[model samples]
Structures are given as structure tokens and as C-alpha cells.
Target chain A: MDFVLDYISVTTFWTVLFIVHALLAVALLGALTHQAVAVWGPVRLASTPGGSAPGFVTRFRSVFAPSYAGVVCLLWVLAFIFGAIIYTKYRIYVRIPIEQQGLFKTLGAFELKEHLVTIGLGLLPIYWYLWKNARNAVYDSSRKWLTIVLAAICWYGFLTGHVLNNVRGFGS
Target chain B: MSAAAQTQSAPSDRRRIFALVFGVSFAVLYVVCDMAALPMFTYHPGSDRIDLGFTPARPDEGPAMYWFGWIATSALGAFVLALGAALLPQKAGAKIPLALAWIVPIALVPVLIYSLKFYWRW
Candidate 1:
């Protein structure tokens, strides 16, 4: 049992973690590519028929769309799982020295709070907008811009918060 | 306009131009953002410095390199999407900048992961 735990605690584990990370990264990229083609390719091609764009977009989307959503959701879940594992295995947050503990703990707590809140509250509204506006003829560029902005905000929040929390050496 | 002149005019050219511009611009932006986020390349932090077997004490250590790698990956995806968009057929007047918009966050995921990992260790 100790050996197993030790094995799990090695840097090799992180290497594996990174590999899985890379795979999910690919899946997420593929999902975005698939979504983009589905939503935009047809429209672009409609303007330039016999130009090969439309057929390619249709084929790519057809191949990709079926698994896109599932893969994306899986990617997020895996990321969270890997994050939790790293946190526990390293004793990173809990083991910090008393003087240094407060800041690290605060940052980690804040990040957790932020992610939970954004996924729980923010994503719902975004999804609602996508669904409701699916066929709406309104040519509101602002809506697209708003979605992009919100995604950017959420992404930055996640990035900065994670970086700040991890700055303190594990158990420093 | 003369009859021959009208026949030669392409109604869809404007939309095609727009898609090309949007697609190309998004690709360039993705590349730039990735470059900005990447750590300047350096030797891998030696294993002996810490129990974790690697240490990157500063942003210059590996951040920029990883960021650019991520951007490259996402740029590939955006390229595919853009090509598909430019090739695929659709409604006569659909104006969605599909490939461009999706490329933003797709390129962002690896950067985010790198940031998280760096934070976990930094």
C-alpha cells in the first residue's frame, strides 16, 4: 500500500497527468473546431458554392458533432479530477507554514468558489441564450460579442486564480 | 449596367470576403495571444532543486514556450474550421463568423491548463 501510494506520488505521476492533459487538450480543440464548422462553414460556403468549402465543412461537422459535447464535458471533469488529485497528493494547500498559509489558502478557496459559481450560475444563462436565440433572426453582433467576452472573463478568472493559488511551494 | 456586365458580377463575393477576413484575423489573434502567454524558453528546472523534481521559479522559465505550443495547437483547429467554413454551403446570407469565434477559447484551454499547473507548482 505504501509503495502504491509512493508510486502515485512520484513526478512520473505528473508526467502522466500532463499526458492526459494533452489528450484532453486535443479533444477540447477538436470540439471547438467541430462547433465552428457546424455554425459557420455552411454559411460561408453558401456564398461560394462549387468552391469545396461547403462539402468539407459538412463532412467535418458530421464526423465531429456527434461526440463533441460529450468529449468537452469529459475534458472539464477530468481536469477537475486531476487538479484535486494534485492538490491532495502534494499536500499543497493544507501543509503550508502558518505564516504563509493564509494567502495560499485564500487564493485556492477563491478559485474554487469562482469556478463553482461560474459553472453553476453563469453557464446556465449562456446556455439559455444559445437555446432561445437558436433561430431568432435578430442580427445582433453584440450578442456574439457578449458571449465571447463572457468566455474570456471566465477563462481569465480561471487562469489567474489557479496561478495565484499555486505560486506558494507545496507546504511552504 | 450592361447585360454581360451583370452576368459576370458575383453576388456572393462580399460574404466570401467577410468570411475570409474573419477567419484569417481570428487565426492571427490566436497566434498572438498564445505567443504573449508563452514563457521564454529555458532549461528545464533541475530535479534536485525541489521534491517535485522540477522547478520553474519565474515566468521566464517555461510559461511562454507552453503558451505558444498551445496557440499552435488551437491555430491548427481554427485553420481547419476556417477552411471548412470557407468550403461548406449554407443559406444565401448567413453572416456568422463561426470559425473565428470558436477559435478564441479553444486556443485558450491549454494556456489555462498551463497556468493552473504553474500555479499549482509556482
Candidate 2:
């Protein structure tokens, strides 16, 4: 940890790529969250006393809930590609040395991050299908679970990426 | 309930099954190849491991090939898996197997994490 500043130097190329990757991850995070909220809800005005109208924001998100699927899937893959590129440096330099230095907890967190991201990739198709057919009654239960799971994965992955990047700037 | 409607709907069913197979296969194969094939081919900077005939890419070189390998292997896997899954019965009740759609991906969380054992050394 103490050596982080001394050894980690962010090059322009890596920094630019990191920015692009982070932006994509953030966009993916927003899309997934918006979609999930649409699924799990917007404190329905109908559920409120006197049964008022839903907010404009809630109405708008719900309308586009089915659309987030493809964008999320695409961004998820792109972010992973960027991460993979950055990972080449992390694997040899940052990660190995961190493990060698015995920062087990930090390293373990990153391990979980990698696992979650890859697992998220696997989940995309089902997630896409569930959301695409969100209007259908048969897939109701599965769609709920899938959306919740994907959102959770995105949240975890986003936080983990940020934490790791802060610890040692992406491939610096 | 007309003949035209029946003809139209049949292809959608085929497409669904095809999508299921291709998607499942792509994800599974990508994970598998990432763990096995890509690592085998990527030349680690400092290592004494013998290359069994096939040359590995230099650790610092050619990231494109690694990415390419991932896409190509998964495409190959998807083609094969789609063909196999398509051959299965497409009866209404038979879609029970597509449950693997959500199941396998969820299951893979642990499997992918386990591969980190090589790195974690714990």
C-alpha cells in the first residue's frame, strides 16, 4: 500500500482507456439500475393513498425498461474488454505483487470482482430474454429474479472496479 | 389459428431455441476458454513452463489475439452447442430444459471464482 504512489505511474494511453472504460461501466450501471427499478418498482402512485399518478421519472423509466437489456449487454461486454486490456498489466505487476505482499483481503475482493463480472456475462442472455418478454405472464418470476441478480452484479462490479482502481490506478 | 399464423409462429419457436443454445454456449465457452485455452497460449513473462509444440503469445504483446481467441472459440462453441440443443424436442412442455438459461449462469459464479485459486494461492 505504501509503495503504491511510488511505483504506480499512470500513462496517457492507459488513462484514456481507463476513462473510457469507467464511463462505459458507469453507463451500464445506470441502465441496469434504471431497468431494475422499473422491474422492482417506483413506489406506485396507485399504491399510495387516494391513488395519485406516478411521477414523470417513474413513468419514463418503466416505458423504456425493455430497452435497457441490449444496451446493458453491449456495455457489459465492452467494459470487460477494457478491463481485460487493463488486466494484462494488473496480473503481472499489481496483482501478483499484492498477493506476494500478503494483502489477502484486497486480493480476495478483486478475485470476487473478476468472478462477478464474468458471471454477469453469462447472465446477459437470460437477463435480456426475461426483460424483453417482461410483458409476458409466464416469465414473471424468472424476470424479477434475473433483473435483481443482474443489477446486484453490476453494483458489485462497479464498486469493486472503483475500489481496485483507487488502490492502484488501472494498470499504472 | 389460420395456416398463415401457424407458419409464422413456428419459426419464432425455432429462433428461440437457437438463441438459447447459442447464448448458453457462448457464455460457457468464453469462460472455459478464458480459464484454459487463453492462459495456455499467453506466454507469461517469466516462466520455465515448456511449450507443447504450440507457441504462446508474448505476455506484453498482442492483446488482440487474446481477445480474438476468446471470440473465435466461443463462436465455434456456440455453433456446435446450438446445433445440438436445436436437435432436442421442441414440444411446449419440453422448454423445461431452457431453465438452464438462468441456472447455469448463476451456477458459474462459483466456478469462475474457483479458478482464481491459481492466483490467490489460498
Candidate 3:
């Protein structure tokens, strides 16, 4: 009984993390599935010219649009804040004793570059692309594609930078 | 159809596709990142520092404050996206996607509240 209790105590954070993780996973799947159904499915169905817009699909897309966009943006922001909180909770940047101080110094320098500096630089392009496309009266395919590409790059940089900064358990 | 012809042929369809791609890609990226960050959070209850991913600290000191902060941030993002969705041209064909976009944020409120209050101690 004592052992089980100890295990639970040690792993409580994992359980919480898993629950939150799972919730996020489901949310992502739902967003993807909803988008797939709303966007791709209808286009494929209406392959023939002037097919009257696949009645039911048309109705569904109109109803789903605002909710889909709003939810996605909300999720993105929440994830970023949550990640930031996690970073704050863990002394990920602190120097562990017995390690060469030089290594910690190197990591500290990298951390600033990766998180603060790089993120600021990345955000400029992202915001610019978003703002530029947003200003247009109609959705320009070229601009839209550019926004997607920029967003993908930003997401990659953000995730990779965070992961690299948090490496632990080895030599600690 | 020619490129220009295709462009003119189905404007609504293209818009719908764009929204779907953007939404799905962004959501998947978020999920992957959150999962990757989970392991760092594993720690003892009373430990001074809790690992969240990028940094470690004592989050328990003020859980309520951060919880509300998360909600406010999420709300702001949702509002901005919803406003954009609202500005899109209204057509019978565009209704379902628009509605879906709006519904996404509404669905999140419950989830965020649940997670925030998950292990509350007061």
C-alpha cells in the first residue's frame, strides 16, 4: 500500500499531464476532422460543374466556420501560455551542481537566443504575413499560402526551441 | 480547368479548404508540442520547482492566478479569430464552415474550465 501511494505521489503530475494532453489530442482531432468534413469533403462531392453545392454540406460549412477558426486560435494561445507556465515551474535554466559551469553558461546563452530572441524575430514575419493577408478584401490564394508557410515555420521553430531548451535527466 | 478559370470557378470552395487546412495543421502542431512538454512536469508534490517544459518553478503558489490567465488568453485569441470569420462574405455555402469556426471556441470553454479545476485544493 505504501509503495502504491508513493508511486501515485511521484506520478501525479504525469496523470495530470496525460489528462491535459489527451484533452488537447482530442481537440486537435476534432478540429482536423471538422475541417476535413467541411472543406475537402464538399469540394470533392461537388466535383461536377454547377452541382448545386451539395445541400447538406453547404448548410454545415456555414454553421461551422466561426466556431472552427475561433476554437483553433484559442487553443493555440492556451498551448503557448501553458508551455510558458511549465517552463516557469521547472528550473530548466538553472545550473546543476558538479557540471562544468561553462556548459551551463553555453546553455544559458542558447536559451535566451532560442526563446526570447528567436521568438521575437519569428513573430514579426508571422504577424506581418497574417496582417498583410488580413488587410485584403478577398482571400488571396498566394497570400493565404504564404501565411500557411510562415505559420508552419513559426510552429516548427517554437516547438524545436522549447524542446531543445528542456532536455534533462542526462548527466544531472 | 485553367488556373484563372479554376480560381474564379469556386471561390467559396477554396476559402473553405484554406480554413480547414489552417485549422487542422495548427491544432495538430499544438497537440504534438503539449505532448512533448508533459514529461518535464513529473515531480514530487512539494518540490520547489515543477517542470513544465521550457522552465521549472513553483506553480502551486498561485494556481488560480495562472488558471484565469490561461482563460483570458484563450478568450482573446478566440475573439480575434471569430471576428475574422464574421467578416468573411456570407453565402449559403459558407454558412456551415462559419458556424463550425464559431462553435470551436465555445466548445473550448468547458474544456479549459475542467482542466483548470481538475485538482483544485481550497
Candidate 4:
């Protein structure tokens, strides 16, 4: 442990964790995108139970929505955890430069992204339970709109984080 | 009703109400706490200090992070509301418009964005 510690530095550690964080965000992005699309787009639903969801778009929406629920929740949490850890790095490194440069809109966007992610985290349990059991009939529209909203939040968070990185990436 | 039927219905009702209560309460609480700056604690990154309750940074303390504390306050408040779901009547879930699960959050989006006006130059 002491030997490995000597071989590493703070920036190196943050960089590794940040890389994992980005990868998790990408995975989370993909999962949420698919689930959101399937919920909104025309597809074979569990209620209906049988049909060929051919074509590029149709097959994309054809996957079972429930399966994505648990995975999305899991990935959301994991990405959030990693992001939270790397956040200090962003604060100390990237954010000071951003703040100094007077990018208020960019800073504002990131601020809102934090709120969006927190809200999404709180909503996960309910979202998972709804999708887990009732993805149809009375709750069909509920599931659709809920998925869309969450997906939108996620997309915003991802894109904002991406843009911020472009402005002043880690270890800046 | 039969025992099995009663058992099944109870959980379904509980779940529905729990989801509604948690979803609506969390969304509203987060926004309210944020706009009001009612954080549970403040983290001053420069001074490396964690001050309980929402507080402005002292001189030379640098930018304080209240976002984490706001999240804490909202999550705590919303969890209490969700817990209260158990005391609700079985049919209570039906009374809560299901659309609120998404509607409240969507409505909050604009408000959340607007609250950042201080950060916006436009």
C-alpha cells in the first residue's frame, strides 16, 4: 500500500476516478435513453404481449421497459456516486477558472444540473416501483411522462457536464 | 375478501400512495429549499469547514457549497412524507391524481431554472 501510494499522485487519482465517472455517465445515458424511448415510442408492450417490433426505430423501442428500470436506478446511483466524488476536483480545479472567466450561464447551468440530479435521485424509488409493476393501462401515461421527464433531466445533466468539461476540464 | 386477496391488495395500495407522496413531496421540497437557501448545512471549500445550517461564508472563506445541504433537507423532509403513506387509507392512492407523479416535476423544471437567475447574465 505504501509503495503504491508513492507511485500515485492526487491528480492521477482524481483522473482515474473521473474517467470511471464519465464512463458510468455514458452507460447511464444509454440506459435512460432506451427506456425513455421505449416508454414513449410505439412498441410491443407487456400488456399487449405479442408483436413484431421490426425496423430500426421499432426494435429500439421493443425492449421490455421493466428490465431497464432496475438497471437505470442502479446506474443512476453509481454514476451519481462517482460524479459526487469527482466533484471536489471540479470545484477546486475546473470551477475556479470558470468562475474567474465569468461564465455565469455556464455556471448557472451546472448549478441547475446539480438540482436536477438530486431530484432524479429522490424520484428513483417511485420510478422503479411504477415501472416494475404497472407500466400499462391506468398508469401507462404516468410511466411515459415520468420516463420522459427523467430522461430529459439526465440528458441535460450529461450534456451540461460535457460542455463544462469542454470549457475547463479536470486538472485545469 | 380472501386472505391472499387482502394481502395482495394492501401492498398495491401502499405502493401507489407511497410513490405519489414521495414523488410530489420530494420535487416540491427540493425547489422550495433551494430558492430559500434553507440548506441543512453549508460546506466552505476554501476554509475546509462544514457549518451546520445555511450560513454565508466568512471573509476569505471562499465559495460555499449549499447544494449538498439543500439535497439533504429535501430528502429528509420527503422521506417523512413518504413514511406517512402507511397511515393512509387503502383507497387514498386513487385520490392522488396519478399524473402528479410527473406533472409536479415538470412544473418545477422552469422554476428551478428561474431560480438560477442570479447566476444568469441574460
Q: What is the Å distance of residue B59 in model 2 from its true position? A: 11
Order of models, best TM-score first: 4, 2, 1, 3
Q: Over 4 Å off in model 1, which ranges? A: A1-9, A18-26, A33-42, A47-67, A89-154, A157-172, B1-122
The DockQ assigned to candidate 4 is 0.42
- Recovered native contacts in candidate 3, as a fraction? 0.00
Q: Which prediction has more favorable lDDT, 2 or 3?
A: 2
Q: After superposition, how far is residue A20 of candidate 4 from its true place, in Å?
A: 1.3
Candidate 1 lDDT by residue in tens digits, A1-172: 3475565765565546645644654554455455445544333325665565445646775543323444444554565455444534333333344225445444544443333322322122222333234433231232344334333443454555445435643323
**Each model's chain A TM-score:** 0.46, 0.80, 0.41, 0.88
lDDT of each: 0.41, 0.67, 0.38, 0.81
Error of 1 at B72 (Å): 38
TM-score for predicted model 1 compared with the true structure: 0.34
C-alpha lDDT of residue A43 in model 3: 38
State the lDDT of candidate 3 residue by residue for B1-122, as single tens digits: 25554455334543453453334323332223332332223333234434443443345532211222222333344345534654556564454432332233234334433333422323
Q: Using Cα atoms with residue i matched to residue i, what is each candidate's TM-score against the true structure?
A: 0.34, 0.70, 0.32, 0.88
Q: What digit string (tens of lDDT, one per residue) describes model 2 on residues B3-47?
A: 443344222355556666776677688678767754223334344
Which lDDT value does model 2 have at B83? 69
**Candidate 4 TM-score to native:** 0.88
Error of 3 at B94 (Å): 26
Per model, the share of native interface contacts recovered reads 0.00, 0.16, 0.00, 0.55
Between candidates 3 and 4, the one scoring higher on TM-score is 4
**Could you tell me how far off, in angstroms, the CA of residue B73 lies in candidate 3 after the best superposition?**
16
lDDT per residue as tens, model 3, A129-149: 333344343434333343333
lDDT of 4 by residue, A126-169 (tens): 78877877623556677788889889999999999999988988
